[model samples]
Every structure is written in C-alpha cells, then in structure tokens.
Target: MDPKPVNHAAWINSLGMSFAEVPVGTGSILVAREETQERHLALFRRSRNQPFSHAARPATQVSWTEAVAFCDWLTQRERAAGGLSFRQRYRLPSDHEWSCAAGIGHLESATRRPEEKSNRLPGHYPWGRAWPPPQDAGNLCGEESAGDFPDNFIAGYQDAWSGGEVHARASGPNPYGLYDLGGNVWEWCQDRYREDKDWRVLRGGSWKSARRETLLTSHRTHDPENYRSDSVGFRCVLAEE
Candidate 1:
C-alpha cells in the first residue's frame, strides 16, 4: 500500500521535528531529518545536559530508554492531536532501516537481525571509501576539537565546527536526506546488539569518534539501555503501527 501523506510542516511546527520519507523495501518510513533537538525533548519534560544550549543542537546525554520514551511520547502526542493515523506510530529505526537510511541497505546480512549486522562493508566511510575524509564530511573528532580531546581528535581532519560541538545538521545528510547518519551523535536503534546480549545497538558515529573504523557506514556499536553520554543521542522514525 502507498504510504499515507504526512503534513511535514505541521509536524515540524508542533513537535519541533521534521520528517523525510525514506524508502524501505516495499514501503517507506518517515525519518526525522535531524537528531532530536533539546527544545523538542524539553516539550515532553525531558531535558539533557546542553553543553551549547542551542535549541537546535542535538539532544545529548540521553539514555536509550529515554529515547524510546520520547518515541512513545511523540506517537501518542500525534495520535491524540489527529496528526497521525491510527495505524501509524513513531519509533526508533531498526538496524536494517538505519542502514537503508545510510544508503548501505544492500550490504545487510541475510540471516542476522538488522541489529546484528556489523562491519559488513569495511573501509567504507560515510563520504565514500576515501581516506582522511573530505571537508565537511561530518562533526567528527577533528583538529578543532584537539583542545578538548587532546588525545582523541583526528590528527589532521577539520570541519566547520569546533570543540567537538554537536551541532544539529552540521554535517550534510546521507543520500536518503537524513542528517547526522555519520557524525554528530550516535543514534539508538530498536534492536539489541545481539540476540544473546542485553545491550542495545548504536549507529552512526558521534562527534567524539576519531578512529576510522567507527565512522564506516557498516560499523555498529552498543551500550546498556540506561547508558547516557554527551556524545550520544537519537533520531526518530515514523512507521506503520
């Protein structure tokens, strides 16, 4: 079935979030154009440490459980406001859905849940396979961040931002037009890192990520459900209920 039409402007105005429809298999899902900002979270009585206090900056120090709660809050808020159809809801994207957003869905593992597929395409950074990364690739640990992360910033890499700042939409969006899929903040996914482990999955790289391995589109990481950090945040996806 065709995806239902969404009033993108209304969503942004009411929720302080924007959505972009990204194709997934036979249907599509509306992904938040950027990471959830502090202002949006504050609307739901959720607040995180704001190093920059910029309302547009990505909300950080947010735990996985909190991210899920935000999704649930958004789902209910929209449903009650008549903005969402009964069959639709907000959620964290699955690992596979995130890969699709990153334009790497083709490398998905055949047998593993999308959350378990890791390091499938090695040596591939978000901005193609090139080394040292191109200018404006993302908000990675770069020369400008050396002062704060003396031992962690990339040796020669630099971007427009400074001091490891997590600017919302600072980096360009992926092919799917979803921002911060590479760097800015690590996003929480719906699945656990593995079936046996209780840890949840985190995708995309964060502003603190300096190593090449972590920036690859296929790279996956995990943390406890209650873990929170200044460099970690999440995006939301609107999908069929």
Candidate 2:
C-alpha cells in the first residue's frame, strides 16, 4: 500500500514539527523543516548567545538531552490534548531511520544495477549528487564562512549568507519533500555514537561545514549527549502504528 502525505498546515500549525511522510511504511514521519528559533522559544529555550537576531532562523546549539526532553514534553502534551492516540508517540529518529529519510540507501538503484537493492537504506544530499551544491542547496558555510574558516570552507561558493547572518530553514523542499537534509545545522540522531554510548550521532552537516565531504548525506559525527553548540540541533519523528 502507498503511504499518505502529511497535512502540512496541520503539523506546522499544531506541533511546529512540520512533518514530511517518508516514502516507506504507512507514511513514517520526518520533520520536513528544522525547528526554528521562534518555534523553540515557545518551548522556553534559547539558542547560543540568545537574541542575536530575529527568531526565524533554525534553532541551534541545543544539547541532545534537551532535544530528547522536547520530544518527551511534546508527546505528553499531545496525548493530554487527545491529539495522539496511545499507540502514537513522538521521538527522535534512529540512525537508520535518519538515513532512510535522507534517501542514502537507495542512491544507485535508479540505474537498475542488480546489486542496487530497491530496499536499500539511506541516501544523500537533499539536492542529489551534483558537486558545488546548486544554489539553494542548503545553508552550508559559504564565502562568508570562508572569511572566518577559510581553510575549510568550500571554494567558489557564495550562498548569500553574510559572515554574521543567522541561518534559517530552506525556502523549499528536497526531492523527498524534506528540507535541509544536506546542510544547515547538524541534526541529532537517536543512536549512541560509540560503544561507550557517551555521545550521540549527528547527521546532516551544519552551516559551518565547508567541504563536500562533510556535507555528504551519509556523513556523520558525534558529540557528548550534554554538549551543545551553535551548529547542533535536532528534529523529532512520529511513527504511526
């Protein structure tokens, strides 16, 4: 059976999550847009160097624990409001799920390669595999970023943002109807980054990411669960059972 698309206004206006239904299962949900500062402020939290600018930018510098707590609070709030049934819950997407939504696993299947499993997991850059990321590809480090971190910023790319401009959510959606899957702020995934389990995996590179290597859809990094930075934030998922 085919999955259904989420009602855009419903999720954004109600939960502020802005969900997109992944093309798998009975419409597994992925937040279509990163949570913005205006949205997070409703939760009563502040990003790094609070009030640096307007509230339209993506919320950044949030700890994994705080992101998790937001999920918990949201779940409880929805349940209490009778918006969520007992079987439905909001939480962070697992590493595998994050990959699936990014379309990383199915990258080469379109070529009809025998080894390319249609059921393969995860995918890459929201705009696809072309180099020099197309205009509006995402909010990655650009000319201004080069001014601050010239050594790492992608050469010959100027994404319009200034050195001090706060990054915001993309104005459009990805091929999968998702946004900012390549660059913006790094998104927290549910998996423990290592055997020690002290850190959590972060997918999708941040505005500070300059190299194409770091912005690859499958690229991953980690930070301590309690650590927060201007480049880190997260989205939540709601699996409907």
Candidate 3:
C-alpha cells in the first residue's frame, strides 16, 4: 500500500492554524487553540499573506456567522487542491463532539436533554476535579482581570496570567492534545443555544471570564449568532474519509 498520505494537521500551520487530532473513529476532531487572526485576515479581508508572528493571537470579537464562513473557505480551498475527498469537509464541532474532544465523558443520548445542560460530569473541571485551577489550568478571569470585569472574576484563584489577555498553545494540551479547551477563549460549537437554532452555544471559559466554574468541561453558555465579544473565539473540525 502507498505510504499514508501526509497528515495535513501536521503541516497546515502555513495557514496560521495549529490543529490537534482527536482520537475519534474515522475522522479526528481537529481543534485549533484559538481562531487564527492571520487566517481570518487573509481569507476574509483579502489581505496578502504575511510571516507568522507570535503577536498574531486568537481572532476574537467575531460573530458565529463569520466563523462558519471561515470553515467554508477552508473547505473549498482544500477541495480545490484535491487535498480533501468529497466525503471530507471542515466545520464546527457539534456540542457533543466538542465535549468528547475536550475530555468530557459521553452523553446518554445523541441529542441534548434539558437535564444535560452541561457536558462535564459531577465535580469535573478541565484540569480535573480540582476546585481552584492550578498554576496554569488554561486562561480565565484571575488576578489580571480584577481591574476590568471585576464582577466576573473568581476570587482567591490565580491562573498566573496577569496580562489579562488570551494566550496561545504554550499553556499545554489536554489528554487529547487539544489546547485552550478549558480557557483562553469561549469556543463556539455547532449546537444551538436552545432547542431552536436561533442562538449558538459556546464552551470553554475565556480570558475575561470571572467564574472559575465556567472553565469546567461541562460549563456551557449561549450567544446570538451576530454577537461578538473580546472573550469569544472558535476552532474547526474536519471529517476524514
């Protein structure tokens, strides 16, 4: 058999995305630590490509519709290059799929139930069963955030991020090698905020979040598709043939 074709996840950084392959059945849940600013500018703004910069942080303050557009652009780009098969495409992960990739256990049913609001189990946070997150358990409202959204900051806990800003993948990865699933930014999932698809669901606490509990793997929130915030960002996933 021909040697396995190159894993695009390993080399797609040129597009300003660093993807971690989740251990799923046929397709892996490819999650970027945060949305790539460079990719957004290049794809949406029609900006010319530029060298990568550490300052190119997560593309925040973008709406859910914009995020979906990015996925479409990526899908078309890959297919046009013959890099993706007809059966493969990149898109946002379903709420359940996002939870599984974030180390949250399985849900009883395929769809959401009123009782299953959160994805995590009892007493489980992204950093495990700890109360206050450890030194670096992912970015969240902490010492640095007391000045701004002080109302939201969790008292008596410091994730050691005083800059009060979202960070990159250096914070470390989860069991699935996915980064920023607990913090850094609230990631958008494919599910609707409610039974109807009007609002969209967002998981993972963000840098400005004031509650530590928000970082729990089961913690979830919702926002209108057109709403944008400095604390919200997203990642994409692809199906593998």
Candidate 4:
C-alpha cells in the first residue's frame, strides 16, 4: 500500500502560532528540533512534586503552572540569546495535536482520520525494531534504575515482548526521530486530568505498563498536582518563528 502523504495542520504550517490560541487540540506537543533531545535530563530535577514517593515518583514531574513556566522560559531564553524571536513560543502538544503527531492512529492511506495516523510509523516501539531487533531499546529509569538489565536490551529482546528493558534500545525512536514515544516513560501533556481535578495528563505508558494498548500513543493517564512518579517525564517543542 502506498502511504498517503500527510499534510501539515492548517494551523501548524499556515496560520503559524498564535500564543493565546486554545490550540487545535486541548494540549501541546513537546517537540524536539535536534538529535540531542535537550534539557530532558533536567526535567528529572524539576523540583515540582517533591516530598513525593521517591520509590514511584519521577523527578521530572511538574504542575501545569510549572509547565507553562518552562514554556515561557524557552521563548525568553531563545529571544534573549538572539537565536529566535520573542514572538516564538514552545510548549507541549495538546492531547489532540500530540496524538496526531504521535503517529499512532495514523495510517497514510486512511483519510486523515485522527485515530488512524497516530501509529502509522513502524518499529518495535519507535527507534528501530528494538534497536538491533530482539534486544530491548534504551534504559528505563522507572523499571530498575538506569542500567539494571543486560540481556533484555534492544539487541537481544528481539520480539520476545514483555518484561524486557521497558522498551529501551535507541531503535525505538518515533517517526520524527523522537525516542521512546511508546514506552520507557509516560510523557506529560498540557491538560489537567479529564475526570478528577488533577492537573496533569500523561501520554505514552511507562515502564510499569504491561498492556500493549496502554503503551499505545493515544492512551492517557491523569495525575494530581501533588503526585509524582518515576514513570512520568516530558519532551518539549517550539512553534515555528
């Protein structure tokens, strides 16, 4: 089947960015412009939900307010450094926008159905069929520290599924060259939880996830501002200047 070429959203490519715009989806995607995936390691030191359960809490967890602050910092930093215009903005993808780009539900042949295109790209997770196939991809912090498992890596797991390295291996990069969009860590989104008053939305299942569907790009988890877990972290993106 010939993969249908996808079109950029009218808002993303044409209208450009309107900071206060409610966004096409109720969230923003954290986009990465470079291969280094920058400052993500700093997310683990967020200092947002401290006094949290270290056993389960990820250091990168932050409140909606904090997320907004981080976004603001990106714009201010870029502008001040003369690298980008102050008018430019960076933020997390709305739940809708994130899913659209997650490449989950997306199949090029499908008529731009939001559900189909999200998972269009193929891989053991995102990178490259579990790095070297059979082997797990990258290391997952929430699973067992940073480097606990050896044989269960991307080069070895191949297709054995479950209990592996929580989807490690550099092979699991997403279609955008983004790594671990499926597992490793459940990424934070811009929405407050749907039901509860919690102020955090989580996409992408964590190392703790067992179901394939849960690991899907569209599955979402909600969390309260006071709660933090090692399973949660985030990526970031900037709007075109």
**Top candidate by lDDT:** 1
Clashes of each: 0, 8, 3, 49
Over 4 Å off, model 2? 1-10, 25-27, 44-54, 107-124
Runs in model 1 lying further than 4 Å from the true structure: 1-13, 46-54, 114-116
TM-score of each: 0.88, 0.79, 0.81, 0.55
C-alpha lDDT values of all predictions: 0.79, 0.65, 0.67, 0.45
- Candidate 1 per-residue lDDT, tens place, 1-241, comes to 2223333432353666888877777777888889899878876753434333338789889899988987887788888999888898888999888877777775675348655467768877777777787776888888888888888888878987766477877777666666778888999998888788878899989988888888888899999999999889998988897
* Regions of model 4 farther than 4 Å from truth: 1-30, 33-64, 105-171
Model 3, C-alpha of 196: deviation from truth (Å): 2.7
How does model 1 score by TM-score? 0.88
Question: What are the per-residue Cα lDDT tens digits for candidate 2 across 1-241?
Answer: 2123344442552535566657543345655455445455454343233444346677777889877876777777788988888787777887767766766533433223212222233324556656777787877787767768868777666677755454555524654566777677788887776756677888888778876657767677888999988877777788665
Flag the better candidate by TM-score, 1 or 3: 1
Worst 10 residues of 2 by lDDT: 110-119
Residue 99 displacement (Å), model 4:
1.3
Ranking by lDDT: 1, 3, 2, 4
Q: After best superposition, candidate 3 residue 162: deviation in angstroms?
A: 4.7
For candidate 3, what is the lDDT? 0.67
Residue by residue across 1-241, what tens digits does model 4's lDDT show?
2112232322321112212222223333335422112233243334444343323212245554555565666566567777666656777655555554555433333234333333445442432233332234433322243254443333223332334333333334444444556555666666655444665677766555544345444456667655555556554556654
